[model samples]
Target: MSSNTTQMSIVCISEMKNSKRVAVEEEIIGMVKLNPFLYERKHEMYKNKCMRNKKFNELGKKLNVPAQQLKARWRTLKDKFFQEFKAELIPSGSADEAVKSKWKWMERLRFLENIYTPVDNSPCSSLNISKTVQELQQNMTSLVDRAKIIAEPSVPKSAAQLFFESLAKQTEEAELTPAEFCNLQIEILKALKAASIPNYLQMFCLQQI
Candidate 1:
């Protein structure tokens, strides 16, 4: 096989293995949820079994054999079969049904196991693409807002005076009653305060009247 093809196959196998691990973890969690007492009693046994299975599967995939093939091979061994059979035969409640459902979901998840390659090695992967795009957009928008502030032209004193004069003119032209003007001025003062601007500017503007 070509190097690229081999690399792609390895990536596929790695992803499949990860999916299987996740599925197995989910199954264990489901079993624990269904029978917390049993899980607590056999916690160490379950932990060791899961770790051994995960390691065996990962090694098998690295060697190019399917994870299921490794599991099948292990199942055929006399000792493995005896242990598994004994575990299965142990008396238990209806909790096995929940575990079965979790395994069924895992089986479905296997269908998506090879959907993407690792992000660092492959640009074509779509894993978490939407989240990446949203984060990039937010960063870009923040950068643009910062740039606008940094590039803003300084306001001349005459321009400031003219701007306020125009605002006062517009307020008068609105034909507001004395009470309405007072309310508008109060709102303007509040906005300035909220923006952390010195109150002296507002006081000066008001005093000009």
Candidate 2:
């Protein structure tokens, strides 16, 4: 064949391969869409390895691909789609988009954002908060026990001052944003107010407001 004909033949082969890859991706997505439990966090199937694998096996039978292969494609497709999805969400003009945000997969996987996006959880919604509260309770309990003792004539610090002095020491190295501090304070104050005994620090903070 002539050099020009040889180049044309190679181009045709490449295009055919690309077309087949697109078709396979479409088939994979179509199968997964029918079984959202495969990706959705809220689905029990997602948490159950046995059930999820059973479903993948079923999908593989129909797609004529191995279960592991389908799982891999799911991951790769979601990974690429999320990259574009995030870039698309960035504050930018339409002209700033990275070549239609990789239109190939974004359009197909855009709807998966709810399932794939990392959960935005409150800072206080963690084990650290529990530990913080537990420490706070222990400190407060120690203070209440101390309060029962008769005050020495030389005790210059006021009840509020002493309580806050301990707090300042406890939180000395802790770095908390204003919002996180306020959220934690609100939760702590609410719990204190709910209890039958009134707290001196709570009363002091409320008086300052």
Candidate 1 lDDT over residue span 1-209, tens digit each: 54654442432323466777545444433433453332232234544666556655665555555556544443333233233332332223534211222333334333222222123322212222212323433432332223223224594334334445555666656665443344344444444434444444434544432
- Alpha-carbon runs more than 4 Å astray in model 1: 1-157
lDDT of 2: 0.55
Best by lDDT: 2
User: Distance (Å) between predicted and true CA of 82, model 1?
Assistant: 91
**TM-score of candidate 2 versus the correct structure, residues matched by position:** 0.45
Clash number for every model? Answer: 0, 0
Q: Report every candidate's CA lDDT.
A: 0.39, 0.55
After TM-score superposition, the amount by which residue 105's alpha carbon in candidate 1 deviates from its true location, in angstroms, is 72
